[model samples]
Target: MSRSPKINTVNEAATKYQAAPNEEYQLVEQAHRGVPAGAFFDILGFSGLTKEELSGLLDVSFKTIQRYQNDGKKLNALNSEQLLKMITLYQKAEDVFGDLVSFNRWLRKPAIGLGNQHPLKYMQTPGGIDLIMDELRRIEFGALA
Candidate 1:
C-alpha cells in the first residue's frame, strides 16, 4: 500500500469527529435547514448499500425514505448526518481504490483485517464507520498485514 498525505489528511479530518459523535448531526442542524433527500439517492447508488440497509442506518422506515425521494423533501438532521457519513466514506473509498467499481467490489468482499466482515456490512453505526476508516488509514500507510 502506498500512502498519500491527502488520504491521511482526509482520514485525520474524519477521525477528529469521532469524539463528538453528534458533531455531524449538529453541523447539519446548524449549517442547513436540512439536506436534500435526493442526495440520499445519489449516495445510495454510490455506496452499494441496499435501500433497506440505508433506511436502517438512518433509523427511518423505508416508506418514509421513499416519501422523501418522491416529494423531494429535505432529510432530518439525523438522516443528514447518516448520509454525510456515507458520502464521506464513499469518497475515501474512491480515493483509496481509485474508482467506484473497485471500491464497491472491496466493500462487498470480506476482509481479514475486519474480522471477516464485508466493509459494506459495517456502515450502520458510527463505530463501524470508524473501523472501516481505520482500515483505510492502515492501508494508506502500508500498515496492513
Candidate 2:
C-alpha cells in the first residue's frame, strides 16, 4: 500500500524546526529573548542555504555567525527579528508549494513577478521577504506569475 507524505503545517514547521517558540504571534517575546545560533543550522540546513546567505540576511559577517554557532550564543535583537521573519516566510512557502523541496527550488529560480530576478538575490533583506511573501500569496490564489 502506498502512503501519503505527512503534511507540515505552519505550527508544525515552527515546532519541528524550532523556528520560534509559538510561531508569529509570540515573536515579540521571542525576539526579546533572542534565538539560539543553532536554530539557523536547523533552518538553513534544511533550506539548503549557506552561512553566506544567513549573514547577508542578518546583516552580519560570516565569521560572526560562525562564532555564534561555536559559542551557542543567542542572536541579537536585530538578527532575532530577521530570523523570525525568515521562518515565517519559509513556512508560508512550504504551505504554498506543498513541500519543502519545491519551495527551495522556487527560491533559487528567477521569477517574473520578481522582475526575472533570482529570488535568493533579493531574499537577503526584510523588504525582499515581504515581496516574496506577496508573490507566494499570489501563487496560492492562482494568480499569474
Candidate 3:
C-alpha cells in the first residue's frame, strides 16, 4: 500500500478546516476558539489582497491588524470565523484554478455569474465568501456560471 502526499494548503490550519469542510460543527468550534493573528497575515500575503482590502473584509482597520501582530494575539470570534472561511476559500480556489497565479487572475477578472463583478469585490463579507465558494464549485463541476 502506498500513501500519496497530502496537498498542502496555504495555511496549515485552514487545510485542516478544508479537510473536513462538510462538518459545520467543527467549523463553528474552530471559529469560537479564534485564529492566530499570524494566520491572517499569512493569508493576506497568499491571498494577493492588499492590507487595506483585507482589513476592510475582516472588518478591522490596518492599525488594528498591526496592533494584533505586534501584541501576538488571537483574533476575535467574528474575525476568526471570516478569516478561516477566507483561508479555506483561497485554498479551494488555488485547487480549482491549478495555481496561485491563475486563481489571482480569476479573482481580479469580472465573472459573468457574479453580475460581471470582480470576485475580489465580493470578498468583503461572509455571505460574499459563501457566494464565491458557490462560484468555485460551479467552476469545479464544469458548470461555469
Candidate 4:
C-alpha cells in the first residue's frame, strides 16, 4: 500500500502566520506628514493656474514664487481669502491647461530665475509683512475677511 505524502501542518501554519513587514511604510508615512510644495503645485495645477499667472495674482515677485515652489514653503502664511482665491485660480488653470504634468514642470521652472528684480522691491511700505501674517492667520483659522 502506498503511503500518503506527509503534511507538515506546523510548518505550513508557521509560514502562514509570518507577517511580512514593509520597511518603507514608515518612511512613506513620514514623507506625507507635512504638505510639501510639490503637493501645493499639484493642487494648483489640478485647479488650472499657470505659474506666471499665479505669481501675478498673488502680487508676489516671480522669484519669490519660485522660491516657494523650490523650497516647499508652508502655505500657513496665506489668508483664507488668498487660499480661496488660489483654489479658484487653480481650478481655472486646470480648465485651460488640461495637463497636470506639464503644468508642474512649468511651475518648477519659471520663465526667469531668482535674479530678476521684483516690481515691489522699490516700494516703501509699512505693515505689509504684518498684513501678510494676519492674512495667514485668517487662512489657517478659516476666517477670511
Question: Who wins the lDDT comparison?
Answer: 3
lDDT of 3 by residue, 32-114 (tens): 88776766666765677778888887879889887776777778887877877787787788788887778888888999889
**Whole-model lDDT for model 4 versus the true structure?**
0.36
Which pairs of residues have clashing backbones in candidate 2? none
Rate residue 65 of model 4 by lDDT: 52
Task: Name the lDDT value of residue 91 in candidate 1.
Answer: 62
Worst 10 residues of 4 by lDDT: 117-126
Q: Worst ten-residue run, lDDT, model 1? A: 1-10
Q: What's the CA error at residue 43 for candidate 3, in Å?
A: 0.5
Stretches of candidate 2 above 4 Å error?
Answer: 1-13, 16-25
Which model scores highest in TM-score?
Answer: 3
lDDT of 4 by residue, 21-131 (tens): 222343224323432333334334343445565555556666765576576563333322243333333333333445444434444442222223231221112133223
Task: Kindly give the stretch of ten consecutive residues in candidate 3 with the minimal lDDT sum.
Answer: 1-10
Which residue ranges in model 4 land beyond 4 Å of their true spot? 1-40, 79-81, 88-145
Go through the candidates in order and give each one's C-alpha lDDT.
0.64, 0.72, 0.75, 0.36
TM-score of model 2 relative to the true fold? 0.75
lDDT for residue 80 in candidate 3, whole number 0-100: 78
Ranked by TM-score from best down, the candidates are: 3, 2, 1, 4
lDDT of 1 by residue, 1-145 (tens): 2222332232343443231333656645532566666555555544656778778877788898777767777787656666666666766676777776777788788977899889877877756876887787777677861
Compared with the true structure, the alpha-carbon lDDT of candidate 3 equals 0.75
